[model samples]
Target: MTLSEQIPSDARIAVVTGASSGIGEATARQLATQGYHVVVGARRVDRLEKLASEIGGTALQLDVTDEDSVAAFTAVVPRVSVLINNAGGAKGLAPVIDADLDDWRWMWETNVLGTLRVTKALLPKLIESGDALVVTITSVAAFEAYDNGSGYTSAKHAQAVLHRTLRGELLGQPVRLTEIAPGAVETEFSLVRFDGDESKADAVYRGITPLVAKDIAEVVGFVASRPSHVNLDQIIIKPRDQAGPGRFSRK
Candidate 1:
């Protein structure tokens, strides 16, 4: 049966990390529209509250980088049938030789361990639901790497592998694990990566109409709404102008 059919309308709970903006925000809104009780989590409480109010979902303050924050956020929201590990980003674009060690550590902490912390805490609740789904938002960098993408690429690869391993472990279980990887999304991702450098952020999507947050959200909604028997392993969404990593079409 489809996920919407398998899940009771009232009891369907989804915990989406990084839900304040971008794909996380869009996904939370879309899921709420599909009748899921979406619990939005992020470091920005004000933004989370606004989004929650607009989407009619619960908002929780979460900093995936902190263990206590993750614990508190998970404890407050019970019965989560879906966990979207979307709290991750890249910090610097310098080459590996010139990159700072702290930047690499930060990327690994958020992209890999952050995802682990949230998923580990919610695994029991998901198992209890008997029709749970874990949708992780990875990136196209996971499969392909280019200049100045060492740390981010490595973290994406690790996160993707973690999801793959979890899917194998939960082979017979009701939990459906999947990953969504997108390329050149026009979002605050680059802004965060450049530490609020609006110019650099704008440059990332200068010539191309990159994938928007809603584009990724639509794919996520479709995947989460699929039949329980049909598991969409991984979906890679990219703008038509962007053929692959670092290969954006420019006029």
Candidate 2:
């Protein structure tokens, strides 16, 4: 890390979940670049360590699906000014009738419940910090349901609800709540959704240009950097080629 990227002693700490890879990793790297002492959390200890070392931040082994792990992660952080909940992904492209219960469970656990656990754990610190930001990464599916996105869509919508409730419930507080919903950002998302089937995953964004993890990460930094008086409730960004859920311009 260069001197320019080093966080000052007085800078408020930023915590990002799922920091091992994808958007979480990108957000951590971007926040570190913005002079924040970023505390990264994920289940993959080795990757987290490497990311922390590379970005000059600290890493904690955290499994958002586990209450104990979330607690342990919060214990390691002295204070938190920004909390980015990005530990979510699609499980399977199954219809509602053919949905696998296990896949749905995993999606719910990771997307909705994971956000609940981490936010509940760190919220007190954010409240005490006076000025804080909470950014939750949802998906376009949260607003528009599709044929094969039953489980993923429902789970992401729950995250969106959680974000909305937080904003309404925390009115007048210094803490701000923002939800970022992106459309078809090419990352590990497709691969994971297809159960590591490279061909299936590759087909999701075959001909059209999709958004990247860094693109969303940059937006996160922008939203979080706004003036304290300005609260951006939500940002729904899609690639120019993506019109909506299941609508893509293929070349």
Candidate 3:
């Protein structure tokens, strides 16, 4: 279905974070195409400007980990119908015993704390919209803990539970919370996780066709377009080659 057709008349303004690239980028474009007034945010001002121009959406400089930045970012939107929290990532894949404290903190700050910062800042706007939606891009790691992914796993799992707790808090409110968990998707995710190691990132999907960013973006569109009474609480999507967390069948 088309965006205009999918969007409820009461909810048309959609805000997407981490929109410089990957699933965030794709979702921003998709929402705009679907007729929502899309507001895209990220640290890369130039890239966001380009994307905003391309999609006819507003672009803002936002650092989810920074309170001041998030405050400034949300302050501009008079009203919002959807908030996509895609501004999280993994740092390194070190085992628990070999983990670096700093790495763990960065992961927690970016994944868990970052989501909290943005949500807290924007919840008021969303609640004001009458029938708003909040969707987050989590990971398959949220459910399965792997050997070398202690920090990332913990952060994701924390975020997953965080949303569940939020649902209870907003029970009577007209806000819907959705979490989109993806498995083995090919994007800058691995590059960032491995600290810009090109070969290591490429090796991640060498044998298997992974889910691209647009795949998740499409899901976001569907969730955003649904009726006000329907809440798609969580969607766990993975490539056919991926069985579970760290379980991939490469060709």
Candidate 4:
């Protein structure tokens, strides 16, 4: 049967990490619109509260890097049929030679280990739900690397591989795993990468109609709304003006 048919009218539980802004915020809102009781988790409780109130979902203060936060967040969310792993980002853009080891460590800790922590803590609840779905938001850097992209790229690669392994391991289970790799999405990602340099972030998408948070959100919704038998393993989304990593057209 179709996904809509499979999802009952009664509240279906959905847990979305990094739901304070960008794609995470959009996903939480979209899921709630789809009749799911979404639990939005992030470090920014104020933003999360605003979003939750607007979307009619619950907001929980969760820092994915903290074990206690992960455990507490999952504990509060009684049931979760869908898990969106979207809490990850990089801080620096430097070549390996000049790159700071601390930056790399931070990226891996948050992008890779953080995801693992949240997933593992919530897996039992997901499995018990019998129709669980896990959607991980990775990046194009996972497959293609450019100068100064090592730290972020490596972390994304780890996340992608984790999803791949999970997909294989959960073959027969009711849960399904998916990885989405988005390229050049115009969001706070670049701003965070550039340390709040608005101009630099804007330059990244200057001449191109890059993907927006809503774009990724729509894709997440589509994947989640598919039939239970159909699993979209990996999706690579990019703006038409951008060919691949570090290749964007200037008009």
Candidate 5:
């Protein structure tokens, strides 16, 4: 049977990348509850399999940085009504002078090209779905720059721009693009950023209550559930305690 034929007639397919944990995992669970057959992809097969089992969805091993992996993952997906480009993260935090070229390369490859690869591979499937939504989880850094965060901020900026540009390029097409830029949603973000330094990661959110992964996932669910005509171009979500990049209200 063809890809479209493999799916239930009433079921809508939603693809979530970076779905091993945090926002991607939350979003996968959320979409599954909404009656979409969620196809979750990530590098962690164990976690992905557990999540897929819990949600009754399919789990596929996907490394967005690998072209063959992306191609293989997308090939089996059949159809995609919603594609969540959430496979991105930050690396080392350092000043330009002391910057790690390896860190920069990783950030660019994962955040920018990773999204491009997955999105490009599934574009045809997205369009063929008749009504599709592409939600890219960006960061506050996408629009603002800060000290010692040039690598991550630059990568996010490029990812956001790529998502935004798709809006116009697909104007009359059957797809809708939404860019979700979140401020301080506490997850493995700081832990990953600080290289598993628990104390440093804890310090990042010590002062204020940060938004959790579920907060952003709910917004994604909202965006995905909108009528086909309603295209939410961009949404910036931050906790009330957060004002901007470095501006936070610490109690």
Candidate 6:
């Protein structure tokens, strides 16, 4: 059967981008448990299929940085009541003067434009569903900047602004927008940032306990389960040991 046909006509559909791992994966699982038919998307088809199998959801190959991929992925989604904009990352920790243009490009493309493309494509569906929620997984970087983190922080700021802008633009619309900004989450995030340097990645959480993927996922679930009239605008989550960016309370 076709993908759109597979989803029940009355099902409350939730589309999760970057669902292969970390926060995205956990959020997809959480939404599935809440009885939403979670349509999981990511660049990794194998992992997406495996996750879909476990959660009884649909898997679609997606690369948010690619316009064609976003178009094709959105084309098959029959309906969307929830959209988790979780496909984003950081690359390199270089100062502005020593920055790699390629890394900056990647951060902007993935974190900023990526969110824009997917959100814009599915907005009509979200609005048409009549009680839609858009949860964007931005970072604490969205709020503050630190040394050697300009590229990521800047992109996050832009992404957060983009999300916030919709709040006013979509005012009176059925769609609700929530931005979840997390701090010190231990996942593949650091590994990717450090370019497979396990030691560097490991050091990021050495002195303090960090937030895990499930923590953010549960919050998404909570927001999703809220009554349609309720709109939880913004949530900033951090491990107890973290005070802010680079202000970790180390043991």
Q: Largest TM-score belongs to which candidate? A: 6
lDDT digits (tens) for residues 1-251 of candidate 4? 53234445467889899999999999998898888888889999999999988987788899998898888788767778999999999888898889889888888988899999999988888888889999999999989888889999989999888878998788888998889999988878989999999998888898788998999999999999998889999999999998888898978
RMSD of 2: 3.2
Worst 10-residue lDDT window, candidate 5: 1-10
Cα lDDT tens digits for candidate 1, 103-188? 99999999999999999999998998989899999999988988888989999999899888998898898999989999998889
lDDT digits (tens) for residues 1-251 of candidate 2: 63224556587799999989899999999999998889999999999999999998888899999999888789767888999999999888888889899999999999999999999999999999999999999999889999988899999999899889998899998899999999989899889998999999999899999999999999999988899989888899999999999899999
* Candidate closer to the true structure by lDDT (higher is better), 3 or 6: 6
Winner by lDDT: 6
Pairs clashing in candidate 6?
Answer: none
**Runs of candidate 4 exceeding 4 Å displacement:** 1-9
Model 5 misplaced regions, further than 4 Å: 1-7
lDDT of 5 by residue, 23-71 (tens): 9999999999999999999999999999998998888999999999999
User: Per-residue lDDT of 145-181 in model 6, one digit per residue for the tens?
Assistant: 9999999999999999999999999999999999999
Q: Estimate each model's TM-score.
A: 0.95, 0.96, 0.95, 0.95, 0.97, 0.99
What does the lDDT come to for candidate 1? 0.90
Candidate 1 residues lying further than 4 Å off, grouped into runs, are 1-9
Error of 2 at 158 (Å): 1.0
Q: Candidate 5: give the clashing pairs.
A: none
The alpha-carbon deviation from the true structure for residue 94 of candidate 4, after best TM-score superposition, in angstroms, is: 0.5
Question: lDDT scores for all predictions?
Answer: 0.90, 0.91, 0.90, 0.88, 0.93, 0.97
Distance from true location, Cα of 76 in model 1, Å: 1.7
lDDT of 2: 0.91
Minimal lDDT window, size 10, model 4:
1-10
